[model samples]
Target chain A: MEQPILSIQNATKIFGGGFLSSSKPIVALDRFSLDVYESQSKIITIAGESGSGKTTLANMILGFTPCTEGKITFNGIDLNQMNGEQRSFYRQEVQAIFQDPYEVYNPFFRVAHIFDMITRHFKLARSKKEAQELIEEALNLVGMRGGEILEKYPHQLSGGQRQRVMVARAYMLRPKLIVADEPVSAVDASLRAMILDIMLRLRDTRHISFLYITHDLSTAYQISDLMYVLFQGTTVERGNTAKIIEDPRHPYVQELIDSIPVPNPKIKWNMNIKLPSEEVMRMKNTVGCRFYPRCPKRMDACTKAFPPMVKVSEEHEVACYLYQ
Target chain B: MAANEKILEVLDLHVQYFTPRGAVKAANAVNLYVKAGEIVGLVGESGCGKTTVAMAILQMVQPPGRIVKGEIRINGHNIVNLSEAELRKVRWRELALIPQGAMNSLNPVLRIREQMGDAIQAHEAISARDLKARVLSLLNDVGLPERVYNMYPHELSGGMKQRVCIAMAVALNPAIIIADEPTSALDVVVQRVVAQTLLDVKKRLGVSMIMIGHDMGLQAQMVDRVAVMYAGNMVEVGPVESIFAQPLHPYTQLLIESIPSIRERKPLKVTEGLTHDLRNPPTGCCFQFRCPRVEPRCLQAQPAMIEAGPEHLVSCIHYQAR
Candidate 1:
């Protein structure tokens, strides 16, 4: 049976505060919802271009930005209702691997400080000796050997090695879920595959769930089990990764997929979707479709009323007027 | 002196960077030839010394980076030993550079037209009217609308800005254009469009080009020949089909397998170890550590480029003489 590990409901995140805040809230996430199941919890890649609300949704999952409107419940513990201790416990279970591996570690601190972090917070090991053992085990899990790696500084390591170190740091806690934000973008092209392979192996061996966040759709399609298509802060499509990629239904989804460089040099593909107009910017205040301005098959009512998520099959759901 | 056939012939070029760590040899005795009107693709991963080789030929190395050995002959002139005064004549009118991350390439405060006009006027003694006409024509050739010339850099999209940069590069109609990572950041559709424009411009102007990029797949599309780089060294150089279809270097083979192609659905076989460190690059074969087919002798000495086949050169000792 498919068992859901976490279920997000009607989540909304609006950034900024005080007098500088604009009249219309910058809707980073608009009433988004999705269910992540344990059986197929290998990786759920949330990918989009910059300002596509991919990072905002990732922050909501990480508990960094509390959703303004709705709830994110992890194993039935409502994230909003949780107190400080409970939140910290939630963090231990759901670790975050942010982009820019250089920024993840403090420059002044030693590499061993990472182990100290897991020790001071989660009490991840049985004793000091056990903790050292665990750190070594985690380092080896990400394909880095123990003796040579831990003593080196982040600057001393290559981009790929440093990224792998971050993965190792996350492995130290054996967290059930990891929210990795563009983890491989900083690394070189050759090393990106190595890091991705490690993550996949971890999912199979350790039964860990991952919320892999990225803007590179090709890499996302390579790894993700389930995927979401977010455009300008709203979920346009969500379904099985293979199905959505093989035959994208939404116009935006099709466009994003078509934009990827294929190996074949002969075929020229333009998704043929036009950019949103000035009128669409004015219609940002409308109640209905956020993608109304750019949608190819848009109707009058689509601008007046928000479309509901229509189920295409048991595993697919699309939020578009055409589908509805 | 005619510029009739040969544009540049780089013979046994070697560049080394003297860091506090050690002397890292960037361009490990590379040799290449560019015809008067042809495109050669220099393909590799980032930090593979592709940029180092390009900069060394341009004589733009700062401290800690130097071209220790070899020759860079451009149009029968030894560029390696050219004085600063002699090289100034070749800057735009002879060969121009279209570097990566064009967002930083353009001047922010200046209008697009002014920036482009400045390049043309600096190189040629043309009237303002003639310069304007040339700038507008160049913009049209690169597929940018005439309005784009009037707008500032902030007003344009990434693709538009890159197109403008291309226009600026071709303003003087140089004999050779070294376009480094020209379409890496662009979306696939936009990348194709930009790449097509570049090819079209190169064809029309009859200018040779050195197109440098990080992926073998991307390079295969536009370039006639491909040169693979790894940790400041050229590992393989051959025709594009040979590089992709029958790669001689084990590293090149691994790279081909790793890219997610339209045909292959299986997860790519990622190279296990990280790239070689630039500061303390290993002796002998830089890729000796992670090579799946590494032999005992590979650890001891670097292999010279050997004839793998017709027009194919490889630097793997395993394929060389016993």
Candidate 2:
């Protein structure tokens, strides 16, 4: 494969975790690294619970937030050192789809205004006719017609329709990467498959890399090529989705997978759940392994220091003393 | 089935919402029942009237939305015909509702104990010491710490707040509890914990429950029987094992297949179109627009629920024609 199109090198983000703070600061992301190659389009998923720092990572990748340590590069160009022109170009190349489709647009404006603004700002088309043609083409790519969507307001469309319009706007820009944060969580389950299918088609036809962030392990396993499991603020496991989901080495990853309530009734769950104590969860000091309080298989060394990331295979990696 | 075994029953329940455009038939001839100490899962998409049916059960349907016709029998009393004063006594004491977004249902200014005490005092008179004991025991039952009784809603996490909601719903020992989307807003791990908490509370209190949610996986794990709804109509309902194993209704079959599975990777089976608009629903079947097995007869008249197997009922013309 060629050089990765986007690379996150040892990115560490600390919120108010600086010097001279009376309260304990939050370590949102700690020494996390990932790379997305543009050789062929693929999906990279970040999976975790509410406080696992997935959103923080998405914001950093979008350049809205900065990392305390390490760097993010696009096409071998450091994002932090980019000039104004370069930063604007980066914005055009990288787009995002947020969780709530209802809040994605301004309700007062017509839906087509969004596409018009994108084309005008990027200088993608010269005239009104050219911009209209471009908007229609992008809408068609997402299986929607222009006439049905152009003159309507945001409130008129359904949740699924609004989300597709957001996707169509991203398509209009011809971006190389799209970061979707729980895009289908608000939509009905019947429409989830369609949204996911559209995403898969985008990757295949457009050769556009996607940084899909969600807490749903099932959908991540279904569509992701690479998966990263985060606990607290650190990556506990990273590998091929099939291998990682089928044979999770990290204890937190295993629990997340097990808790996905299979649709089959025969596979009953063990009701005796082991939850982490609130004291260990709310502790301020950064001592040993962050998952030591909830890990089913804890070791003495795990408490002494954070475990080193070990290679399970050429593509699989885990951070735990047991794996070592 | 014996008369007393049926703790709650809704027969020919029709609820409509009169909008400026037209009268939306939110629920149409929906029939369901919950036996003593049994849990029934009501599964459907949004705008399918799952929540409307639940609201009708509690007699809390607001203006412009009324139960047009129905018999809601709870503990041998017809609640539909009861007076406001009579219904007030049966509201929380007989049928309790753990509403959607219940985590935020707690008052921000008051302590947790005050909220639970309000729920209990609204029904029956209890001494202050007894109320505290009851609140602590309910909190303990849901795996919450005793210290939470004094903390306000803002101090608790999302899962903790939901647990408090569950504790409040079952405080007065209601005969039936209706939990509408109880775990939809929670994380996956915390969702499972909350699901487990519901099961534990049900076992301890022996309260019949009607759980409304869109996730079939959680329903399969929790409910004793499953009821599938589409566009305000009951499509199919049966034992959980039987419904999941051999779903008769096409919509129900498609819904079960659409759920993504981590155990094995396969292409998801999605329904053809979006759910129908309630205001202008088709004259025949509620799911005819999205059903793959639609026929000429299906477009002419609605199919009645028929026994497909032992204790299994499905409302599809294809299944009924055979």
Candidate 3:
């Protein structure tokens, strides 16, 4: 079998823990693993609420932070052990799309400076004309015309247009994987569809796998192929997107799916449903299920230790003891 | 006031921002009303002037921007021409506001009790004991614990702080509360929780509300009526069910079609034209540049709001011709 393009094995990231400090260490991400194969390009969604460590996982994969344990390998090369040259290659192969498009650009420069910087750093083209061609082609991929946006300052473009330019910037790198963190959350409804459509088109045409990180499961359900539903930094459920959204098994996953406000007015949320306080929800259980405090179906067995992932179907796995 | 009585009415409102280049017509002849206890949603893209309209209602539009021509009536009293001192008397007691990014609205140094107390104390003459009781009850109404009263704003979570804002907005039981994107910043689960709190408070207090947001899904679930805005113009207004089920205006149709759904996956139907420059809007229709059903007549004159269905109003040349 061909090796996966990117593989993460038992990656753990714990923040602020040393011999000198008295405060307990916060486990941002605990033993998370995922794989993206080169043969098929896919949009894999890492979904969870705030502080569920979706961004932490993205940070580790993007080399923004190092894992406390385990390893992340890109095409069989461990990320931490990469030399300067290998690191550059990895950087080119992996790009990121942040949440706020407005803050990403420098206000002093024209929007074209983003593309010019990338091309200059990578030496993507030798001549000015060649560089222009590269930038135009990238813009075209995201359904934008370079002539309309290149000369304008960042403030001139709307939120949706700025985000599309960001997508074009990331695509220009020709990365194997794009880690998009809440790319569409800041845009409007119509433009959000456009950006998500661009991502779908990129996956099919460019063969670029995407690690889409978002708190919105509705959009994730629309585009992602595979999904990992995280609860307090632990993978509560992992499966095919359609399967998981259609038949979510874990208690936390079920609650999440139910909480999403459906667009149709005919479908209303159950108003009687109450969530636990933030204090209880954020309480960490070091030796047991993190969701135990808020889980309606929690039991004594759950508090004994963190449940292992058990296969519910060929492509679906859940970490609840009910499945055990 | 009676249930069907109009608690708040905005008629022929025009708000403009005078920039160095030109006057940006942020709200052009906008018209909307809220019946007692009704939750009317004002939704549009970022710069569609939804927030501007909310600020106009509160009489809070700052310099370079002003309510050029309009009449905002709360309980039959026009607030647009009211003096600063007169308006302050009408503000929290009659027409309150839960501003956008409400989590940051609270002073970080002040405890929730002191902050909420100040709003009440400014408008009323309650004793210290009575004020404390009133604040605690307000907190309880929003499902917040009593302990939250003494906690500083920084100590509360985002959801908690938002609930505090909601509690504060209802402190005086105002006739109408303008909530500007009340749940936009929170996570999905927490957003739903805050949304539910809003609904509960409205139902218990019988206060009318105007919710401003871009999230159609949340609007569908939370609001009684939905008003669609495009480029500083009111394009469509109808009951929430009818607006979602049978959107009339071209912009409304596109907006509804653009909302991504969780029930099933479908091809995204996005309209492709940028909103026209607000400073130099077209003569006939504000959405003519992007309207799929645009015609020459649409550019000849601005379409007036016509009755499209039972209690549904749409501003489009097609309906006007009919």
lDDT: worst 10-residue window of model 3 chain A: A273-282
- Model 2 clashing residue pairs (backbone): none
lDDT of 2 by residue, B253-276 (tens): 888889988888897655547677
Highest-lDDT candidate: 3
Residues B89-140, candidate 3: write the lDDT tens digits.
9999998899999999999999999999999999999999999999999999
* Candidate 1 off by > 4 Å: A1-5, A14-25, A38-40, A75-78, A264-308, A320-324, B1-4, B274-284, B297-301, B318-322
> lDDT score, residue A315, model 1?
69
A best-first ranking of the candidates according to their TM-score comes to 3, 2, 1
Higher TM-score: candidate 2 or 3?
3
Candidate 1 residue lDDT tens string, B177-258: 8888898667554675677788889889888999888765567667878888887778888877777778889888877777
In model 1, the clashing pairs are none
lDDT (Cα, tens digit) per residue for candidate 1, span A156-179 = 777788888888888777788888
Candidate 3 structure, TM-score to reference:
0.98
Q: TM-scores across all candidates?
A: 0.89, 0.98, 0.98
Best by TM-score: 3
TM-score of chain B of each: 0.94, 0.97, 0.98
lDDT (0 to 1) per candidate: 0.78, 0.89, 0.92
Tens-digit per-residue lDDT, A257-306, candidate 2: 88888888898887777576567676733667888888888878888888
Residues forming the 10-long window of minimal summed lDDT in candidate 3 chain B: B265-274
Q: Which regions in candidate 2 have their CA more than 4 angstroms from the true location?
A: A17-20, B1-4
